[model samples]
Target chain A: MLRKADTSATWAIAFSTVFFFIGGLLTTVAPPMIDKTWSKPFENNDPSKGPTGKLVNYTPQQLKGRAIYVREGCWYCHTQQTRTLLSDTIRSGWKGVRSPVSTPDEFVYDYPHMFGTKRTGPDLSRVGGKYDTQWHRTHFRNPRDLVQGSIMPPFPWIVEDKEEFESLVAYIQTLGRAKNWRPDNDYEK
Target chain B: MPEQTSGRVALGAGGTVPAIEHCDTTAKWFMISSVSYFFIVGIIALTIAAKFCWPSLLGSVQYLTYGRLRPLHVNGMLFGWLLPADMALTFFIVPRLCAVKLYSEKLGVATAVLWNIIVLGAVVTLPLGMNQGLEYAELPMGLDILVVIAWLMFSYNIFATIFARKYEAMYVSLWYIMGTLVWTAFVYLTGNFAVLFATGTNQANLNWMYVHNAVGLIFTPVGLAIAYYYIPKSSNTPIYSHRLSMIGFWALAFVYVWTGAHHMIHGPISQWLQTISIAFSVMLLIPVWAAVYNFFATMKGQWHQLRESVPLKFLMSGVVFYLLTCFQGPMHSLRSVNAIVSKTDWIPGHAHMALLGAFSFFAIAGIYFTLPRLFQRKLFSEVLANWSYWFLMIGGLGFFVTLWLGGFWQGWQWNNPAIPFIDTVKALQPIWLVRFFSGVLMFAGIVSFVYNVMATILGQARDEAQTV
Candidate 1:
């Protein structure tokens, strides 16, 4: 069959387009079409709503802080996704435990998803309520000062601007606490 | 004298050789631009590497902060360096192989200019905290439009030339080039434009689709085209088998699209998506190995040429690295291994082996092989070329090893609740230091390459002008 007349160009173009269509339909296009139970946030106490209830949305400040996160290209280093795998779960203590896997509903509000490719630092999936706002400010000023060997770049620029700094703090502290599964604490202070 | 006499004899038998209707001016300009970008982007990468070791180094400058500089380094490498090198090769090879001059030198020059403009926009805007936030498609909409315009001009010029070709039979390299051009345009539009309307996980899924395809369709096909043209021509042999080349080409095209989803494995995306991606990713090894074997078989008796020719040395070494990337790709795409290395440095190290080791080597070789011919003179210094090759080879290997092992060390430690996160970062300090120094060596190697290109092109041009 390979020894047939030269149709290399035609075959290459046709197969490439077809494979792209199939892959797109199955992976990219199909995921959003199928409704899953885990696509939304839920609490154990809410029996009527079930575990797939509509999760609370981010505050305006948190949204602004997310904008700051994207602006600074924080996603390049810090990934927000915690997989169901043991290694991922154990490493990233989501909700103060080694078990809460991230679901689609957690990212329903994410316009441009921050499921970063690299984890140069610890996962930020459940980083909200883990550290105080003061710690974030100091770390952003000089990461090395707080964590001796931290590779995170200093965001002194973000620190100088009070609005950007507070917004970013608001954003970081809300990472894992968006769902009402736990008593959501206001980390604004 | 005997070699010169034999060359004339070969020329006599090598048929019509149609007036050498080449776009030498545009081709030389593209090569020079690509080398300069290599120098600039190499320095930015070195800066990024240093920040990983000394977090406070240049931390005060908001523009040079790790986040901004990271994108700068990425865009610079992708658009500034690699893309130009690939386009330059297309400019040179397409015309010669088709026995026709480029359709429009003016359009080609315009494309090159606009290409750099789009990259310049990314460099300026990203550092200023003005960005669109998409990983590979980080440029703002205005600049993205400019990129599309530049690519359109380039595609039209090449296709017009090919359509009017005086040659009868289309070579395999031409087929590859045409496929790359069309697929690149399709993926770029779909990934960047169509993605703007997509929301949530759908956007993430499509983003990976674009990200992975950019490497698979654009760089892979174009790099292979350069290899298909140069390797056999240098070895004084036909391709090992035209039949195998077709199989490799179609297989690569079919398998790569399905494999993009592997990047999203265990993330917010569905389980079925991961399954399809991993299955196809493992299957991807077939095409990759087919090409690898074809290259080695083509060079069966000509292995000794590696010591003599710098271009062949780069091309052959690229094939070896290509093999490693494919092997590692399949292994890591599995759910188990990916779970361990997904967010760790292992993936980055592996990505570099493909980007810098495999494809970048091919680009450098294409430049070296074509530059002298474009200028009608031999290279100025083979010694400098050899030195550049070794430094990059050693430095790239060293860089990959440190990151690969350090990634595993960090991942394994992170899995233990007893090990604090900061402690993992501390333990990896020595590896980071090695990575930094090795990066410096790679930077030096690029500097040597740029200097050699300048000396050869300029020095030879001066000699010819004086002779005339």
Candidate 2:
């Protein structure tokens, strides 16, 4: 007995209401499920106490550079975390003669894993120990200069401002502190 | 036979059954070419996916890795198959809607041929791995230029036709079509940056912005326009509400662009950037929900048409999935939530649900609805059309659920310092198997639809053609 237009309007309202309810319900419930399934069992984990904690020794200049990195959206393309699994750790330089994996107890204090997706460029989780400050500066200025095939857009302007540059370096060094927690390594000396 | 001839003669005496036969032939050729293109690209994508399931199938070529092939499959679907067919529908619909013949048949044919050439360029460059490495901008710079040129030509032809309009008030559907064309051209040019040509860190921000707009401005508008036109026409009624349509259209145009940064949630981006992205994404629910409401409301009482009309079946089902994708998209944008699901198959599940489930379904419906009128013939088999609908619908649902669940599981395990990454992959092996099965079902559905479309265009003329 309903007119066609009325029927359509009613259907639209019903469908939208149903989906809205479903979406809201899922958001409310998803986090707990994630925690239940994924929470790690490491009790003694504290990233600052590990060998990579050498980053804690960063100078004021390096710390300043790190802050700038965060401000410029560089994290959108780069990740600062590595899994302990052999394949990923090896491929991303988290393990080898150059870099070794941190123990399970090392990572518990981390708030949000800064591991990024979309490797628009190489992984930056261990970049603090891998490249010198000058190299980092040049690469940030124009990535293509160092790596011919790199698709990373140059952050040349990051260098133009000395204060901002220092903050960004400081931020980048903090990324993998758990893996390099040893105190005497002098990460930013 | 004599009685039938006498009846036909009597009816024909009134008017000479205007010779639209030439239009019919050309339209058939266009449909056949486009559908074949769809089948070819679909099969290639399936094969690439299969290669992922069994890596040995790809031999030792770096070009065949999951990273490269993923972009190729996506591009093939978005550009090769979907875009061509949508263009064909536009060519057919714009003329009829305006109550005039297409302004230039030659231009239309030229656009169709250029589309194939651009897709061919993708085929050549992508396998060579000569990419810009930006997601959705993987087509090499040279090929990207070719595509831009083709789009410019197509936009020119469409706008010229619009300028030549005889109707005083532009219909809602025309607004959507014109907006999509103009907005896409501007976004494509700026985002790709032929001027900057891959220089600044702006590339990251620019890439996501362009790709998201491609979804919002280009595909979403075109799909909605087709739905608006066909749903009302097929149901033999005016749309449920014109004002709601205008509101949905404008709100979407304004709000959707600001949402690209949601993809960067929890990353090293500025806190404000991520925050604003999340805010706008959540706000997007307003316009999206309004559009969903309009679509369902328009179809409310017309359940009978859904049962009998193949086009209606595809269109209504598409609307259902569009609501699902938009809601999921905003949820994934939230930082707390994205902390777990970012960079996982969950993202692809949402993407496919939007592109395959929503846009492609509406597109197929538009094509099916226009076929009889354009070609002057009945579908080769309504039963096959019904089968295709159910196959795609069920298969797509299966694909979405399995991938989303698997991605969630992977995200959780990867973030847990106690859980080994290998263990997470081990846990997900079962889910990936489910994905393969669901993918098989989807592939079968696409093949069946392609076959049905081909038969309709190529089969011998029926004794009594069905009117649209």
Candidate 3:
């Protein structure tokens, strides 16, 4: 039995294909300035001057942990950027200092922001002063011990070696440089 | 049994059979049992949501907290309700399409049973607040094992059937079904990696990847496969363009995975990654629009079928929603757009529009179209089917509007530093009321559909029954 291609189907295919290409093309071309405008002003916070300065640069092993994270798609989940705003700060327990008002210029040297989407896990944008290397290592080995309701899978393999564990901790420590220490007002209080 | 005998003869002659002999009565029974469980679970979720919209109706319990129960509601619909139906349809459709019997009925039934256990385990565990806290991936580790085993079993059965098929040119539906099964296996495994579980960072990326792919690679493809087959089969015409189907399929597969990051717009991830995600997400318009065009074009002159056939009603309505969902999805992915709507009801509105509106509707239509032919019975009542369609249609439309508008309102209000969150939620009270009412209508529609399906299967057949 011979079958003829329907005209309607042909046209549908042509139209949709054209639309897909156009949509893709439009994204590459800078969106109109008005379309890219933000409602709020960006804030600036520098982490290098904060307590996070206590741990700058990575050991080779920590670099490996970062490599593992990228290779295994860990960035798919944890975001390293925090908005300098109240709502996110409140939810993340970093309210007041780490608001959405924070601007990208604060991290002028940083390439591809690791700010993640979805809150399946807590934001890691301000990891510098939150926990110690041991906490980071133990949590990486088994998050359930730290948070009973954590849905995060265990990464025992990453922490199996002490050197690797230190490196991984070092990498995580580099995540949020700007808000590693509480503001002076809070400390004075 | 003349119809059965003719079907067998068609199979023997290698002629195109209107239907094939459905082996595995046990699998069918398991599917029915799962569907029943899903219906009950669906109603319970709807009731909970109803109470949430009107909190006075039910006092608070930790187990039924909005945070806990919302995930339950979503999981039940996706896993308990839709997954089983899609699996059953796969078992039925693949064999007929391939001119072969399922490789093993026992394996099929085992998969169904395990799937039910896994979903039930989630229902039991989640209410206790023992969840993984991941949206859609909320099932705890123990239950995740069961789901993984069930998926492996399904993958094996589907592959075995494909290998055993007699057909030379595999139909488009077969490609989609096979793709869904194979890709899901990889997608699920990667998304739920044992290594990344502790870092917590992996969870977000994995969850977004899994959730997005679950829609794009798994549910969307299966739903579209059914549409591709049923639309042409019902119209008694070959598809308009085989080449387009191939192109659309490849484009969709390539683009969808990269697009998941779009959900993370303005996220702390690298600017390059976000830009890439947005670009690919916008690019998705090609494959998606291609599908929409193909579907609409196929129905160009056969528009009358939409009026007469309940299956067509579901299918066409589903196609329309698919277009709407894709359009809205890319729009939401835009960074400026995400700044307003992220973490709000807007996301759920998109989800419902795609999952419930597009995929679920198409899945039901496929089941409705295939059930009678497989069972050798007339549909119990056209009237009940029509009523169910209208109920769901009206209810779904109402849900889309109210949620979309409510989401925008919430986004606008939350974005304003001057406006407080509590007052924004308060402002949404009326819209939430509409959502609850619409949900109730949808619940009624689901019950009606279940009733129609069950009665048709068990009820006495008419003397002059027409072939489905």
Candidate 4:
């Protein structure tokens, strides 16, 4: 009976391994390699040349802010990716005009992808140019003061520390902006 | 792992075996650690839930920020509590089932110590803003390696015991345990390593895979393993059908791994990948129902046992939660439902229903059943045990239902861009308060349960000492 059970154990091991491999390969491995079915990564490590919009690379200051963003886990509440659906496109966009869906190419430089799982706050995919630098500084200090009933916790440190404030605002201002997306909109058209 | 020196000895040298030869020291330590952590994690969770309603309550200290505490809360609950709880139960239950002793109690204890170190590192560093930024896989690279080592040690001990078993035909519970040993390692390595090699959407896919599978492979199977054992044993009944157990085991192994990508539905991914995930996710029902059916069927005429037997009460409640959680899983994975509720408060509600509701109950039941026999004492207080149960049941139910309603409300509000986002936050404030209070009730239950167990064991030890 033990010998028979050993064989069953081996069978269990083999069955699960095979399935894990197949599932992982098809989902994680196959998609990037098969560009026709999915998406091709951006070449020259340039977000500015992404397919949907021209996104400039982050300044060094903005990169510093990006690190702070990651450290603070801003991604827990705010999602970076805007989906293809109308709700996401319009919701992320300020005016009647549609925001382009977040594609893999736009995230080429994103080493550890921050396509966050939750959206307690509104999606920040196209938050670039939505508010000026001063607005962000005050909002971070006391979120509820600017936006009544906002449940976001105050980050007074962001206001007090110059580097943390400037860099974070700089990085956020670069989210999902095309070369002339809001200015000369005819480029996208 | 060295085989036992003799039948009476649970391990070779280096183990201070318990006063009762049958009860392993490592199991006791792990159980005590798990219970203590469960209580600690509850406080952590309550703080976070409090911050959700009263955002400024904890102040703007960097270490105590929402993001840092959120990950710590998660890691504490998973590693500090559930994983060790399951490990402790495995140590106690497996040897008896196999008609053998543990491979090495020293190794088991060492692994438990290392596991604590790993969690401690996470608790400290996460607050200091040191993290890998992945949900569930947030431990930095160094600690992650330590985890792999700790897992290896525990697995070696467990597998060695199974190999040395005198019992020829392995029971259903043993099968589940063996499956978890293999699946957790595979899922962990893949999830952790994927960040190094994979990038962009592939990383996202792998991340969610890790997130989903961490529970599916680790907690779910172990919870079921203990359930398969304790439910029948505590209820004083034979298993309903051996064939059904086989079907359930094989089906769960087949369906669970592929469904991780369901978390990425309507997000940027290949359409086929999303399709495959949803397809496999729905198939999860087969295994869930099959196992649930067998458990219920086993208790056919044992209704009174559920009332009399404390372990049976928790195990039955666990089985019911398992059924509800699995049903919720597949329903939420659907495209339409995913669009509405994927990233809302609903997902956390679903998660707690699985962990706090189903798995924690199983762990509680296992500890209650095993500890008494080991220490040679009746429970400290049956009334307290029942009290803990009622508190948790009401609290867990209130917590889940409120978040679900809040999730749907927020989801609808977010979809309509015209509605100001602040309105949604304001609405959830009341729900968050309710969640915080529900957590308080759970914390109360945990305190009660832990107190009862500790008193029982300490009293039993004192009695034994007096007689000796």
Candidate 5:
């Protein structure tokens, strides 16, 4: 293998491109394919068990609030994905229900995918409907007012802006209910 | 060959200096701009760090909210400071190694100007509540296009210069440089554009891919390339093993792209992708250590030079940090460890060591080495440089330790069924304050850096005027 003292730049570039491209395809490109393939069967056979087949589209107000969430960078401190681990599931699960493992279809409509990297605060996947609009209002206006020692900065400006405040509330309320747990809400009713 | 000679000759014939004949001015502009960004972004980071301990520091302003400020700090550092500094060194390195001029010096300068504008755009837009909400790829679609185009122009300029090179045997640094340019284009485009088409799990996959590759492919490779070039230069020796370098380069390029999905481990991403990410992350240790060993081994008899040469000191310590980062990276990707630290402050701690400790250290060292050549004078004060160096080293190390401990504490407390979330937040307050002060020290280091650089250039001008 070391016989040749000189390696071609062409060969080096070609080797890297091929492998990296394959890796990219395998991870980023291929997963969607896996989703498309597995999604239908999971939808038909195990709708109650696995993923909710279709994502519930956000209303106009919810979309506006979603935009506000993006604007505010809320995802930096709060993660939306409740992973399968006990630590994540236990905290993020709905009352008396184990947290459903987040599935591909649940995010079918999410463009930027807000499955955040950190959890400086708690996971927000099941935060929707857990608290009333008033709690969210008070909390956003000043986090430490409700939760002692919270490092989250006050969003009093948002509280004053009714549209943005309600919009963010609407968006927050759609988190876990976007797909899998909507059925649970329906079942409970 | 004739074209190369004719280009040089043509420049000599004209009274106006050939803009493409050398890279000094363009590289210097990038270096200066990069250093300025370093100081500016360091302050923004300090503000965010302060907000951690004192949430009301600027809590009244809508724009000064922690959410907005955090992204500004992150994007400002990534796009403004680190990337441009890498570009500056790349421009400087390419010409000297090839024994030829830059393909277009004006193009390089234009790219730097546009890049600064783009960074400024991020600074304004993020705070103005105009963001796309994806981490790392947070720039909105409009600005995302600008980034792609900038890189396109940059890649074109770089490749054209590589094509016009007078040297025959391609060095290892050239390979890394080319890899960075090409891979960044691929990563940036796919990360931003492909997400528009993808939804749900696919989007998550793509986003993490972009996020991880931004550091692993672009910053990591570029950083390694600088270390490869400078370590031997500063040590006054040839590389210990070319074979080892070759092994490192190939292994790194093949391994790193696959490792991005580790960010999505235990999440909704397919299990196989997680497995691929974990496997490759562990495999990454080989290339990482290989490069580290090569750097240290090259310093066999020259270990004493670390005391005298500031650049070598920075570069060697940067290598050690890189080694630690890579070690921590593979270990964290393990499912067990990932469970504990995946969403903790620990991730940011790991990131700081890589960005501040490894690459930014290399960038600082490169600036110290190149400024004299660009300005035709020695640094104005060795004391300031040493001071800045110690500040960065201590600040970086302290930040890493505090954040790692805080992350662990938060993760452990959160894992307990009985502990409320507020308890975890309260527990980390002291650590967060330490992080803020450490960040302030890092900010001070950048201030020293800017002052020293300006003085070095100004001192050269003064000396020339006196001689005249």
Candidate 6:
């Protein structure tokens, strides 16, 4: 069991790891480059005109709903970020909706960034104006009733729990509406 | 912490026990605790997989929803099951490798108990929405601090033991253990606390760095340490080449940390950063193959041991899965492949092949090989042990295959906007069901393993130390 104490071998591993680590960090060490049009809406009057208007901060109620969204793990299934691809923009919302790809400016205040990794359901990046409040209420209560093939779990608590339902819906409407809003499905067309 | 007849000598190296004389309390408890988490977190895994099939299975309970349960499952599996298992085996192997009793058996036991408390904290906090919203570092701040403290204690014990070693030259396994102790501390701290200071998408940088290195720096190295020690010891041979071992350890340490940004390939992270990460990820193949070659080469004359030796069987196949898992990691890092499958079920499939298939195999093999030595008793049932292996093999393979294929379909479907997103989710339902059943099979295998281990431990001790 007694091998040579090979302190050099030990030193090699420790130093090499430290060296490469510093090199690795050096690559990403800079603060992320801020986008040119981060929060600026395309049109001053219309946030949805293009990716030019300011990103709207959440109202107190929307903030409350964002908490519920996180608490319920909506981010696990419904992604918030739109990838830099045609399919992501088209699939996250229909082409007529003119959904912009998610940008860092829209998430300036996103503390624990809800830009989820997977699309277990759909990208919620442009879900803000896609459906009305009543539609969301119905969808949250029993998703299967609205969408035939949906696997989203029913949040019946939101239906019965007054404050929970309001906050969640408020947050849902703000998804892509604040800055990257698409007011109508036919806008881009 | 329980019953200890202090002065018993081990059945060393070949036909016998651990390579040293020390109290088994710390290592044994850590082993038992980790094994028990297999059932606890295995159930959690099954439940999570099941939710994909039946999303409303626990629809009403706020705590039991898929969202809360999912984080718990990951935390439980990583911290509760995998990390603890690695520590358990490390506690056992390092002392033997160092040719010294553990520096402080009492401290080891205390750390073991404290580690459990940290996991328990995860159980309570995560379900109640107390998570930090970080992936691997999800445990609340208090638990994170507790974990760091526990690691410091354990690392201190291991470092002291190595320092006290009477030998002039250290082994390859010792090199890995030492490297991981230093690397994990750096990775964990940077990922968890430092990210708080990063604003906007910048946090994603630290996040990926932390999570990827969590596997690369922490689990992979230590898992190799166990495999390196157990393969040679179980096969009753020296490593095929000390030089290869040297190349593998140094190369892996250098490459692994740089590859963290691979997770964000094609995403919003800087393009150059992604390219650099992917390059380093591919470079990882060199170290991975080096280790794999060494393991297989050591098994050259010992190939026949696969038939008669259950532990060797596990150790060897673990090597195979390690090869497959490592291969997939770099392939997925490629931008072309990453564009399609990075966000799909393929990611988890890649992960499971390593955690459940590769490392769990090594950890279990280590337990199977070392348990008898600790108590100086025979395995209660070889039939049961083999059953565990086959079950895990089938189930683990099934889990990876179904998810990999399913994830590809998902990526393709999403790529076609005409298909509609809901349809894509619907298309994956059948695959999710298959994954759920695979989860069932894996749970069964774990139960079989736990029972076999329990019976072996409780069975009568051998009368004579020289019997083997």
**Could you tell me which residue pairs clash in candidate 1?**
A39-A105
TM-score of each: 0.92, 0.71, 0.74, 0.92, 0.92, 0.91
Off by over 4 Å in 5: A1-8, A37-54, A94-96, A178-189, B1-23, B460-468
In model 1 chain B, the worst 10-residue window by lDDT is B1-10
Tens digits of per-residue lDDT for model 2 on B318-348?
Answer: 9989999999988988876886777766777
**Best DockQ goes to which candidate?**
5
Expressed as tens digits, the lDDT of each residue in B1-468 for candidate 5 is: 111422322212433322344547778888888888888888889988888889877889989888988888888999899999999999999987766788888898898888878988998898887877778888878889889888988888877776676555567888899889889989898788886776667777777888889999999999988988888887889999988998898888888888878998888777877888999999999999899999889999889988878888799889989999989999999998888888999989999999999999998999898888888887877777888898888988899999999998788887885787878888888999999899888887889888889889778445432432
> Residue B151, candidate 5: how far off, in angstroms?
1.6
Q: DockQ, in order, for the candidates?
A: 0.50, 0.04, 0.06, 0.53, 0.62, 0.42
Off by over 4 Å in 4: A1-8, A36-39, A42-52, A55-59, A178-189, B1-23, B460-468
**Quality class of the docking in candidate 1, CAPRI style:** medium
Tens digit of per-residue lDDT, candidate 1, span A1-189: 432213333444455566556665666666667745334443355646532234567789889999989988999988888787766776665445564678766776676778889888888987777778788889888777888768887777788899989888888876766443342433344
Which ranges in model 6 have alpha carbons more than 4 Å from their true place?
A: A1-5, A8-13, A31-50, A95-98, A181-189, B1-20, B460-468
The CAPRI class of candidate 5 is: medium
DockQ of 1: 0.50
Clashing pairs in 5: A65-A167, A107-B200
Global CA lDDT computed for model 1: 0.79
Judge candidate 4 at residue A114 and give its lDDT: 78
lDDT of 6 by residue, A1-189 (tens): 112224443454457566656755674464354433322332355445555566666789888888887777777776777777778777665545545677656676665667666678877877775677788779988899999888888888777888888888777877766454444433210
**What is the per-residue lDDT of model 1 for residues B343-366, given as tens digits with 9 covering 90 to 100?**
888877898998999999999998
Q: Is candidate 3 or candidate 5 better by DockQ?
A: 5
Q: lDDT per prediction?
A: 0.79, 0.63, 0.66, 0.81, 0.81, 0.79
